[model samples]
Target: MTRFAVVAMMAVALVGCGGDGGDQSQEAAPEADAAPAPGTVTIVEPADGAELDAGPVIFVMETEGVEIVSAGNMDPGTGHHHLIVDADVDWTLPIPNDPGVHYHMGLAQTEFTVEDLTPGEHRIIAVVADGVHIPLDPPVADTITVVVR
Candidate 1:
């Protein structure tokens, strides 16, 4: 498997580990006996308004049953994460999973690898979407700002 695929698989494993048991499909039914709780999203790294250096790929998140439904453009009520660099980008657009400008973790994992950022001020925001890859109505997370030196 390719390096990216390996990383992706590992991410999926981690996410699945936290799952409460259901089919592999992101569209899987919430659980028969338990009603699906209102999911939440949060950035675990580079906290809100953090400063970072350019080099290692940083991990961002949208927690709460987060899944990546598309490598580009997050589907509504679905899955995924987008890394915005140098500017404010919309989380609702169908941005491709280009490793250069954007890292798309489609329904595979919540973990992100943010490597090779240019020296300057940049912002990273993570959003959690539902099964269709759309951002949650209220948006699962807040935009995190970071400075890369």
Candidate 2:
């Protein structure tokens, strides 16, 4: 046989040997049917309905399925925390930056301190919001009531 014929035959054989004798469809693998868990936020320091001494209250927050990032980081699945104290949130708007009511943790801080809480029951909420201080959709937040003596 000529060298050209031999080379052609070798190439054909190599191509034929590259696949199994079964179906040769190039379909992609099926994606997983399970969906991702929803994001959430929780208060980690004080248990709900707990009474404590009156002083600087330290609030610690935790998040799941989302990362805590500084303000202006509009990346998906990342945001900072907001501590809303004794005030209702207007979910349609961005979280307020007013102190003692809406405390914005724009620095990505997981914990914050509020001093001189009056001797009474107070409602505390930990909310996760985007870089622009807007609360997350479906509102990833946790609320707890605490009493100060």
Candidate 3:
């Protein structure tokens, strides 16, 4: 008797859930075919801890499993570079745009040039951020220090 009652209730439930008259095929959100892979970035030029002339420095970088794209939706393996110059990086949010410190290298930039630097030691941090410039949750980044003369 209990089994019969359960079956009857399920039948009524199915009837209530009959196909909706609304559009059911609009389109699904974009989903990456492969699971998100780990990503890494590094500053390749201006060897860390090297001293150089105070004017015009070129920063070269590389990445693995990461595409430097303008900030927007999370495309699994994509983001942009944020070059943090002479200061500490606040990993809590999008890399800032202050000309003196934060450098937002949207449009998938691999290298950036700093035209001038005061003669002194400075720190450089390169961060990879998702579309919209927000650093990934784990925050893929690299840091190096250099001195200018």
What tens-digit string does per-residue lDDT give for candidate 1 at 1-149? 69999999998987878653323445445677676554556677777666776688566564455444554544444555655554444557554446666555664565777767777766666656544445565566556667777
lDDT of 3 by residue, 43-149 (tens): 88899999998789999877766666766657876788888887876677767788878888776667889876788999999998887777876778999999999
Could you tell me the C-alpha RMSD of candidate 2 in Å?
A: 16.7
Clash count list over all predictions: 20, 0, 4
Given candidate 3, what's the lDDT at residue 37?
Answer: 45
Q: How do these models rank on TM-score, best leading?
A: 2, 3, 1
Question: Which residue pairs of candidate 2 clash?
Answer: none
Stretch of 10 with least lDDT, candidate 1? 19-28
Descending-lDDT candidate ranking:
2, 3, 1
TM-score of each: 0.55, 0.76, 0.71
Residue 123, candidate 2: how far off, in angstroms? 0.5
Clashing pairs in 3: 71-131, 71-132, 72-131, 72-132
Q: Judged by lDDT against the true structure, how good is candidate 3? A: 0.77
In candidate 1 the C-alpha lDDT for residue 119 amounts to: 76
